[model samples]
Target: MGTITTFQTTRRIVMGAGAIAKLGEEVRRLGGKRVMVVTDPGLAGTGLVDKVEDLLKRERIAFARFSDVEADPSYETAVRASEKVKEFKANVILGLGGGSAQDVAKVSSILATNTGGVSTMFGIDLVPKPGLKLILIPTTAGTGSEVTPIAILSDHHEKLKKGIVSQYLFPSVALLDPELTLGLPPSITVATGMDALIHAVEAYTSVNATPMTDMLAMQAITLVHGSIRTAFANGGDIEARSKMMEGSMLAGMAFANAGVTAVHAFAYPIGAEYHIPHGVANSIMLVPVMEFNMLGNIPKFANLAGMLGENVAGLSAREAALKAVEALRQLSKDLQVPARLSAFGVKDADIPGLAQGVMKVTRLLANNPRLLRLEDAERIYRCVL
Candidate 1:
């Protein structure tokens, strides 16, 4: 018998080239009087912050800004953002930028209404109360953090990445403006686009996958497969950018409901320990993890080959499955994604430690279609090493 599953997303999702123009009205509709805009220094420097500030000014909305968000945000970052939220007494929190900024805003918004730090709420569904009204805007085409009920924060003291998963983390709105992504460099475009691909593939092959999630994941896969290269090569191509952005959001919703498997399970550890960007870490582990998982679900992988636009008309399921793995490898190669862990400064001796760190994230591993034992985890890390 198939397991029943429930799909959930933000209350509203707005996407398009000029979608960001609706930000002020959306905040007003949410009954926000004072807004706290959480973002990062890089984005602040790029004048995107000025663009958002202008929108707020036009709407006559009172707003405060916090631009200290860091990549792969730390637990302390959440607390600091939360403190600023309280200081401004902001009734709404607007997260602007990529995954890290969105994560900081999500945690900070929740912590503003709840008790204790993000540490106390690690693991699944640990948030005890609803948070202030929150809206998320993604300037990059990855890490659908806008739609997911997940916030990943690094714990510096422990040298590990932890996630806070709860319905409370879902933003009130997910605003995706492809115009905002026009300036993304090719490398970031590749890394983030692949991250979305991983989300869709992992979710489709997850133990918790359902019909609805599969529908969403497959479309996301198709969209990403069709548009990633164009989007990477021509950052200003609005059509390509729009497709990637929508695909990323769908992938995010897919994984949020169906759960991610070993790829993400392994990524958290690598990202936290090495200070790698989350999307890049996922890109690094994606091919090896998919190769490991292929044998566990050949038919699904075969279908994936077709979704990824591989020529599999005359191939058997098993043959097509191999094509899917090859397709991922070729995509990564073409994108110039680092092919080995050594590229990230990880050594062979680090496999065991990475394995041990992965074991801490069984919440994700449990959803792997194949059971990833400790030995298997070590072996996967060693293969990539």
Candidate 2:
């Protein structure tokens, strides 16, 4: 028998339609009076920001809005946001957009409370205290940033993406309202759904997997496999959107506790270097990385195949694993996700540098079922290229 540790989800998750409407009530319940609403420019103009403000106004909760977040939010931006938190004297922070906005909000909250630059807190569990109370509302059904205890910020000057992982970073509340995702563009739908798929797959195959994590990861995989295409094909498909949102949140919970493996380790460098959206980068690398990792744990792959709706009965574990990779590849191709790094503007000559970056992501690489060294990472990058 293997040792299985209990998994932890620190956030109180409130989901379903009209969940956003309860944002004010949830904040009040948390005893927050002054709050800062963090969001990106696109969502700021979409009236979503106003809707949240209206809810707060009706509840008589004092709030300020900060809509300066950008895609691949940078360290400088986080610092700027932290200043806003201080200036507004916000007692709570509301993250209201996709991953970038959520990440910026989390980092800003940390910086506002902790006395240091954002760079000082990079890596796991470095923050000594919980920051401001945070309520995360994810408008996109991807990234799973709402529930994860990690936040990623880009360092443009360093040409790298760094993360801060701390249980303290977990939102006090995660408000998931699928209605907020209906207006997401089709391209974003495909990219983010693929990201959710990668999160579940990587978590399931992670060496640190526990029974609790496995259940969440498997359910997440099944949900994404069943509904991603429908959501991508029809943005207004509330049912599909709801499922994807749930899957994304579940994946975040699973991976935050159990960790992620090589796909994410590889995906991060691509995102940092190419400025590719995080989800798109994950989609591009997922199939190839999964194929590479399949030999490490055949039974896990077989189970994944079954979860992805492959008929694995009577098939050898190896065969079933291959089927899982094939299904993922087919899904990516069907959704128009870029198949190779080359498609995202990577040159063959750049594989060595990317491989080095992948190897440097030991936090994630350590969780891979199969140990990944520079040579293997290079080979995988070349294959994907």
Candidate 3:
């Protein structure tokens, strides 16, 4: 008998050119008299945070801003944010930046009600109750943390990335405003957009993929591949920005259900050790991991060429799969994202330990199309090095 599956995403998703205007209404609709705005200093500097605060002020909603969210936020960072939420007595959380901010928001929401340390909530379905009402708005077209019921926090003590998976982690609403992404610099555009694209690519190829997840992943792959270039060249192009943002949300939904494969598994170790940005680390591993995985499922990998806008007219499945790899290579070249660990000062001696780190990411590795061994992980890192 076929296995039964379940799909989950944010209950409400609001998307448009100027959707930030709806934030006050969304907060009020969630019965929030007090709100916490979670974000980072960089986005706060962008004045988007000011605009959100203004909206909340106009609504006469009491609010507190937590703008210290760091990249790869730790469990302590999450606790501090949650403490601020409790201090402010916030009833709703407004997550208004990229993955780090949104992740902290998700964790903070749960931490407020779930009476325990963050470490206890690390595994799947561990949280016993639902989090507070949460509204996440992405300022970058990446991560898709707004839609997914998964959050990753840096375990600084262990020097590894850790995740919390629970239905309670899903936000009450996901607000996508393409206008918010217009100010992203080209380099970040490449990195975040690539991250979104990789999520879909891995989702489509994951062993646990379902027809429902594949549909979302396919649209994500098509939209991100088609529009990332245009979005990179013209950040102010609302159309490109809209598609990229939507693609990211769809990819998040796909991976939330289907899970991402070895690309992300390979990324976590380098990300934790070298402090490479998540997207950049994933980009570095994409080609090599996909090359390794395509042998197990060439037909699925082959379809990626056409989905990514490459012509695969008369080629064999294996050849078409190779085209997909070449397409990623060319895309990385065009976007100028770093494709080597060597750029980040990672070297030969680091490979074995890093490979060991990759093995422990069994959550993601279990979804990899090809079986991965410790030796295989070492080889993948060295090739990229």
Q: Which candidate has the top score in lDDT?
A: 3
TM-score of 2: 0.97
**Model 3 spans > 4 angstroms off:** none
Candidate 2 local lDDT, residue 106? 90
Q: What's the true lDDT of residue 51 in model 3?
A: 89
Q: Order the candidates by lDDT, highest first.
A: 3, 1, 2
Q: What local distance difference test score does each model get?
A: 0.91, 0.89, 0.93
lDDT of 1 by residue, 1-385 (tens): 9565578889899888899999989999999889999999999999989999899999999999999999988989899999999999999999999999999999999999998767789988889999999999999888999999999899888889888999999999989999999999999999899999899999999988989999999999999889999998888899999999999999999999999999998999889889888888888888888888988999999999999889999999999999999999899888888878888899988998889999888889888988788898899888878
Best by TM-score: 3
Residues 1-385 of candidate 2 have per-residue lDDT tens digits of: 9685866775599999988888888999889999999999999998889988999999999999889999999889989998999999999999999999999999888888888677779998899788999999999988899888899988887678888998888899999999999999999999888888888899999999888899999999989889999998898999999999999999988898889898888888888889989888888778878888999999999888889888988999999999999999889888988777887799989999988988888889889998788888889888878
Residue-level lDDT of model 3, residues 69-163, one tens digit each, is: 99888889999999999999999998889999999999999999999789999989999899899999999998999999999999877889999
Clashing pairs in 1: none
Model 1 scores worst on lDDT over the 10 consecutive residues at 2-11
Least accurate 10 contiguous residues by lDDT in model 3: 333-342
Error of 3 at 21 (Å): 0.8
TM-score of candidate 1 relative to the true fold: 0.98
TM-score, per-candidate, Cα-based? 0.98, 0.97, 0.99
* TM-score-based ranking: 3, 1, 2
